[model samples]
Target: MVSRKTLAGAVAVVGLLVSAQGANALSIKEALAATYQNNPTLNASRAQLRATDEGVPQALAGWRPTITASGRYGYSWENQRGTYFEHANYAASISVTQPLFRGFRTVNSTRQAESIVRAQREDLRVAEQNALFQAATSYMDVIRDTALVSLRRSDLKFQEEQVRASKDRFNVGEGTRTDVSQAESGRARAQSALNTSLANLNTSRAIFRQVIGIDPKNLSARTNVTSLLPKTVSSAISIGQEEHPSIQSSLFMVDAAQFAVKTAQGVLLPSADLLGEASLTDSNATGNLGPESRSATIYGRVTIPIYQSGSEYSAVRQAKEDLGRTEILVDVSRDSIRAQAISSWGQLNASIASITAAEAQVAAARLALEGVIEEQRVGQRTTLDVLDTQSDLVDARVTLVTAQRDRVVAAYQVLSSIGRLDYDNLGLSGARYDPTEHYRLVRDKWIGLRTPDGR
Candidate 1:
């Protein structure tokens, strides 16, 4: 029977192991959604987008009539015949000022605000797309490292078997000391590879945690290799140009700049304003019985841009220059999108080819290793030959795993280039964690994109 202390120790050990497992168990989809929802960088960008929603109200200000109220109170006193009297007067009035015209400035400014709002939305989209790309890349990296670790472990097992075989053969005088030494060296190298792979896996997991706010040690789902290759580069580029968030955001900016130019030009024209005011006042002096007064004013004012030290002209010119710059930037963005799509498309295909070749190489290496082992058994191959072949097999497996992971990641990269790597395209549908849900909840409220409970 176990003592109480031993039972307690065993329970503690089990608890620790369970805690460790829980800490590492995160799936790729979970990580992706968590990062998209909770990542500070992405959330900050969402807030920025919501902040931009205020532009509409600001622009609407130009088109709305403004009302203001004013009030004043005063007390006056004068001494006469050694007697004193005091009086107080209060007046209040409300006025409305309507801008009838401003060289279309109000209209143009409103349009500029609309363009800016659209641009900000595109900016948010770009941010989301980039975050998804980074999260996906890190997820694949961890998977690749994990695969390498498995490969190293298998190699070590194979080498250990070889060492056992060599020991038995040497005991029977059928193998030399060199055979045993070679097997030992092979096992050591395998152990080193295993250690390297483990370290790399840890590093990848750390980055994954940093990005998605979760450790992914339990994310063991295999990537579907069959779905990794795209059908055509032209199709990819076309989709990317149409949907890529960066290009879309840049295009929106170009439109906004165009509107700004119009608004600036409108500043060179005449403007009309309607102003009115009314006031009531009362005053009493020590000698006088009492005093009272009233006043009122109403007028329509039209101001034409006579001159402004060339500042208005300079603004118009500067806006035109800005429009020109934005037009060029749009073209530049188009070219950049095309280049990225094409480059990633090419890499996707290259990775596919490399994976196929690596698979073939792995098969050939395994066969060669087996042949070298047989030759060593028959005294036709040196111990080093067997060890070298074993090393080649390990390298072949490593290359295959790398190629496969790259191919899978490249597929996503291609999708990312085309801006199609979103939840819908990826089929992350149904009651899944929706990052945009939070944005929608507070979008119409004055507080904007934040929960009432202040998450």
Candidate 2:
């Protein structure tokens, strides 16, 4: 019992391997907001998603017209029937080609690009959830470590008082040498334990800073996300399997791969294009000049593929196999998400029970410690007995502190495992980042050198 709190706090501190701002310890929502706004991982993922946004326009390019201009000039000297002549020739042409048909490759390729964009958006969602989870865990760890340090200090103070009382009684010839020695030894150990707890608190504070982008202050710790979770574990699993971003992303990948197979198969079909061209040519000699000539023409072109070494067939087969892989991955993601929901649900229930048990144990230990101290004063108990009881009280209080932290952390885990731990779900205050805004801005874009935000 004396060692349990020390072990729990020590473990949490070691894991902290990163706090809070303002008057009160930051609430879970506020910390989540901070992470959402400033975390590098989340921001980078958003940027990556934005890059994916351009794929739609690129795919749509297959349906657009291509225009080109060319100009050529040449000079020549020739002798004809004893007469020397110098001639110069120049030509200029402009042409435009609009795709009339492309075996439906453009349509399928565009659909595939759109599907990839959707998948990347889900990837962004996963990043957001991960950052928020880290922030919440770090916040709770700081609170637990801080409470353990306070309890350690109080226990140290109690031990110091015991040492002084034992010394006074021994000077008055009432307490034995063994009692004084035990009291002094217990006081030393308590001091050492307090130092260890302080170190743990410092470690937890460092981790808090790393995750939440701030140092820990007097972080208050009262909020849990139980309301965001489903009422039953099975419900949680069902929700997770349905709503988790990993599953959604993988499903979108299946869609993209299906479209890709079609796009590749389209390669074997004929393509048609309508083209228009205009040209002007002029010729001049050293002593003779010719009138400039102008010409214009419009034409329709078709390209029929007649088996070029089976590359397109290979591509079609490869795309079909990739589609199969993506479909299997969808099941993989769903299975992982289901497991996560069940494990988080179990942890939440266990934490709730532990908290209740720890509270009762703390109350009983405090009463026992008081009784032991009074008995020591009345010559019915020894200094060592009082030290032992006080240690038990501190351990009980530490257990309660750790259990409370666990309860809050477990609630958030349940929320995350079910794919409900996000800015909107938590109802965080601030401007939410809308990925669709970027996707819409870039999807149909024809020409641009800079981003929508002018960057």
Candidate 3:
């Protein structure tokens, strides 16, 4: 008869095997840090943010004076009354033009640029959150699939042993041939399941590499992010609307679009500028004349726009339409964020319940399987009964593992929905990318071809 001690030993062996495999496991925090540093999508978003930083300088250029220098050298020939003459002339000029007024166009344009830069910063934040969430999900997936593979392999081994035992019993006239055939069929199904699980593990590993930027090693189970989540769904939605990067970015975009409308309206107003020029000219002819002259001038210029084939008015109308569209987009972003928060909150709650139920199921299945094995040894239970109980135990254990993985992933999803999945909130240890430092370095910079860090 199968004793309780024997079943307990079997459980201990499985535990030891899992523990040995996890000795070199990678933690979730380390995986997130690696993704933050190496993810191509996140890095691309940062590069785009840096590119947006240049918009401020481009806008500020409108308020600064422009200086230009030009030089021309030419030869001239003329023929009159059968006589030919040749002359060479050289002229050089330097000019400066400073904008005195432009109906606040530069001011509104600068405001627009600044607003856009702020929006892009929020976009970068969103990208970071997404990358971290993906890494966490992939990490959980690998752990779940790995555990399933191990469970399936163990089940296959048990089924193979059951088939051998049934055959021996049938040969000795203690078991029927039908019992041996059932055992063999169960073993075949277990083998198939193991193959499927191995394939799933490979797929999970591929995704882990794609998201985490490296091959997955022994991955440890991670603590859930439930502590970082809101206590209630209402609070989660409130926080998401207030702090979600997508919503924040949309708000800034609305502001930028408003400024763009003002900038377009400014085009209809008069513009004024101060202009200064200095020039030197030299002329020489082969016959007898050579003259050199220098001149300087400073003046104020005013330009008033009257008509332009209706293009300027059309531009103002277009800008206003764009502003309206952006305002609507702000609403859209809020609705989308709210929905995500609610859905993620629901998922988290469901996963918690599933884990609870799965744990109970595993415990019950284990006891049932042990009882069946004990009964079969005393001829009370058939071989088919034992095989069915074992299969139930394997499935229950797999369900429990899957539920645990879902719980972890769902918690992270909740954090991400409310914009708290970033490195700062997670307390990930790494070199955080600071967008403000780059903005500060380049915002007022007058002249430099290279970036602040000499990139």
Best by lDDT: 3
Which has the better TM-score: candidate 1, or candidate 3? 3
Models sorted by TM-score, best on top: 3, 2, 1
In terms of TM-score, the best-performing candidate is: 3
90-168, model 3: which lDDT tens digit per residue?
Answer: 9999999999999889999999999999999999999999999899999888888887887787777788778888988
Ranking of all candidate structures by their lDDT, best first:
3, 2, 1
List where candidate 3 sits over 4 angstroms from the true fold: 1-24, 287-289
Report the C-alpha lDDT of model 2 over 90-127, residue by residue, as the tens digit.
Answer: 99999999998999999999999999999999888898
lDDT agreement of model 3 with the native: 0.87
lDDT score, candidate 1: 0.72
**lDDT: which is higher, 2 or 3?**
3
